[model samples]
Target: MTMTPSLPSFDLQIDRADLLEMERDVWNNASVPARLKIEDNMYDVYIRYRGSYTRALEKKSYHVEFEKPGIWNGASEVHLNAELFDPSHFRNKLSLDFIRDLGIHTPNSQHILLTRNGEPLGLYLQLESVDDTYLCKRNLPPGTIYYAVSDKANFSIKRKRGLTSGYQRKLGNMQDDHQLIHFIRSINTSPHEIPRLLNIENYLRWLAGAVCTMNNDGFTHNYALYLNSEDHLFSIIPWDYDATFGRKVNGDVMEYDYVSITGKTKNKLTTQLMKRSGYRRRYKGILEEILETKFNKNYLEDKVMDLHSSLRPYILMDPHIHSDIDSYDREPSFIFQFIEDRKAFLRRELKKL
Candidate 1:
């Protein structure tokens, strides 16, 4: 016998025109008006497919933008993650939970029972989308330069390669690429000078977070960089975490200490910064603090178990389980084992510092 956990509900209503378009195989960049009802209240949302991998799924993830906004608990938009990768349907949840606990600039999320036009679409992770409103909600300056980077040259001398090639500008009014060019130049030319152009503590925490979670995809892509208008520094924000917690992009399995857990990254700036004596020490200290505090295996195990227990009953109700419901049902304990093992391995690995 198992008990299901309580979660929020979203009954989504998309018009037939949009529904028809969405059902097609090439619905990657399509959008439709969606009427979403949370309890008796309703909000008009512009819904569209928004992900590289998840775009190819039968049950896909979505980006929901509110046409009108006042900020509902700091969220101006939302994403419905289909949890296509992990059968336990908890990897993204666990990752977000870890990020929030680390006290970083990350989108808040929760498990929610989703219904499509009165029928169950299955369990989805309803995540708050990180955008301009996210900055405002945290009382951060609205003029921050935000980039949704999805390519290589990730924080490198992108200006040297081509200003238009590396990342997409989400906000801010840049007269030209000079600001980003200068930032990249500073990072490449003077690593010690980063404190003038970036927030050291924020950078340290972000690098530490990726290492702790073993987010293999986070270094160059799968991340958002915000040049804080107030502080005039760049900070990393986490995104797309189903590939973490013992998994790699090439289908390789990750063990504890799977990654270097240092600032050394494909991104030139991160690699250069980590080479510095002071930055390396600070990064090591942050890792130690994480291992001692929030990333403690026992604490994480409790969360994994709780998520699995609550979702067990609902997972049974899910029509799409990749292989079978039984295999899916057993994934919690498997991932839980990963969490415990990863922590143990890191402890032994980080004991040097």
Candidate 2:
């Protein structure tokens, strides 16, 4: 007899209100000392707390990082919230994991579950913090940075325009010919002995192909690229996967094109990306390969189910995923309008190439 791996189990029917409440409880009661502290960095939430038995002895909590603050506090280990619960999001993580497992330079991560008051609240996948060393080690231009904007955080490109400094400067700008050249130049340089530009381009095209095949909403803000001091550039690891798996708009799959904002204006990067024959050709292959994968459907479905099973019980009592459902719903008209405008913008820009 052969033994099959037992699938992970979770609850998907929980309301959003319960999830939020649980999040609050965990925020309040996790074993952090009173002297421990938390600070919001605008980009991410940071927490300073008492180290665990293992961490205390090592005095290395300073080196320890979690994807989301306190996400690991009450759990046996830290993990990302999306990977443990949200089905669509989890599938995205699995896709990324598959990519990394296949030798891609994706950020490292592992699944984790969070509980509070002796009850399961939710799940998260903890990610290895990609240090500034990874960025600085590469030789990049003076002003190179990366960012990711998500619906949950309202960190879209449009929203980022008002922000200043760090990664924000990279946003809020339309793509132009000169900017395109600079972007290409930055990535093409040899950073830390790595073929920074080529690898970054390859990954972008690859991601585009994957997004199309999976019917994922690959918004420009959802992806990023970074430059290091070594004059090298690399693709920032991807995040957020809750809106994938055959999700479509207007009978057409949602394709992420950073070049166009609502199909009207072209981002500087998009113009350059379209001009690259190598990127276009590779994108074609990526889409084809994604569709051709032997277990594509099964893989996706199983991933969703696995995530559902792992988070169901805990999510049931949490309010974030279920209770406040109305808060999560976006007006379809607005999204469609943006898509239509962006498509038109891309069409015009593509013709320039």
Candidate 3:
């Protein structure tokens, strides 16, 4: 007997007035009170529009916050990503899992079906929020977390023209800004202090993951920095990876060689580290190891195929991305080709380092 796979469904019920207010100001951070029903359990939650440009899209992503703790697998908050930009709808989870395999912390994600006020919203990728609960789940020590909201989050002293800071503090007090400011200053002025202030090994692994996944937009933004309270060292976690795996953030098909093996150099930390032979050699070694193990044609093909098989049944039901159904079905081959070409490119580039 063959059993069909299914996804967990969430029914969100919001007041008509609240829903209208939310739709009126899509960019506002204010969340409207709502009720989320999962099977027989109904939870009090707050729902709001999530993502920058996604708020303007026909299909929208949402940020859901539970009024109480320990809801939905110990997550108090979750982001429901519409994944409108990716044809395959697998790159975000795949990239995060790949980074986790390399020993860097990443958000846990899964596919879920969402409905608002009895209207079907289709498939969404529910991503675990990086907060105190996330740390507790992994049994990590207390730390401060900041989201790299823009390119200015680059480890540089200069802020983009009018912006004050590129990062948004998710946890910790206002004093945490001083620590991040000091770290940025050190990155630009005191290169030798990097080892003491930053977790070099973890950063190297994260860098390697970003390079291998070809997340061109991940360098300065789309990541989280965790400042360990005990050691006062910052470690990065990958985020917003739907743009990875041979696809641009805008849903364009990216060239296999679009990103270099060394990754983006605009960031002061990465640029400074790459100039040092020791860090460069270590990064090269990490890239080599990943290529030999996880980034190969065989391993990635199986992964893409498995994801495709699981999502094929649901892809057609997703109104946002289903318009290009053929593209979704054929994405596995495209991704496999990207992997084969990228492995060769990285290997050749690694030798040059």
* Clashes found in each candidate (C-alpha, N, C closer than 3 A): 1, 51, 0
Q: Which run of 10 residues does model 1 get worst, by summed lDDT?
A: 157-166
Q: Output the lDDT of residue 22, model 3.
A: 94
TM-score of 1: 0.89
State the lDDT of candidate 3 residue by residue for 1-353, as single tens digits: 53447888889999999999998999999999999988779889999999998789888999999995447788899999999889888899999998999999899998888888879888889999999999999999999999999988888776454222788999999888788878888888899999999999999999999988899999989999999998999999999999988999998988888998878877789899999999999998888899999997777777777788888778888766667889888888888888888889888888788
CA lDDT scores, all candidates in order: 0.73, 0.38, 0.88
lDDT of 1 by residue, 1-353 (tens): 55455677888899887888877754557568888877677888888887776677777787887765534556777888888677667887788778868778787778788888998888898887667877877787765545555655366754445643556777766653566667777787766677788777877787778777788778777777777666667777788787777776533466756676562357676787767878777877878888888886567878887887788777777777634578667776667677677767767866554
Model 2 misplacement above 4 A: 1-89, 101-103, 116-120, 132-145, 149-201, 213-218, 228-231, 246-267, 298-305, 308-353
Of candidate 2, the 10-residue stretch with the lowest lDDT total is: 34-43
Candidate 2 residue-wise lDDT, 1-353, digit = tens: 43333323222222455435434543232332111121212112223322122222211122223334443333222223333223232445655665554334454554544333334444445444333433333332343445444322122223333322123323224432233234434433422223334354545544543343342444444444444334444455554443443334222334435323222122323334445676555554444454345224444445545554554444444444555334223223233344344434444544443
Return the TM-score for each candidate structure: 0.89, 0.47, 0.96
Top candidate by lDDT: 3
Stretches of candidate 1 off by over 4 Å are 1-3, 25-28, 68-73, 158-161, 249-252, 348-353
lDDT-best of 2 and 3: 3
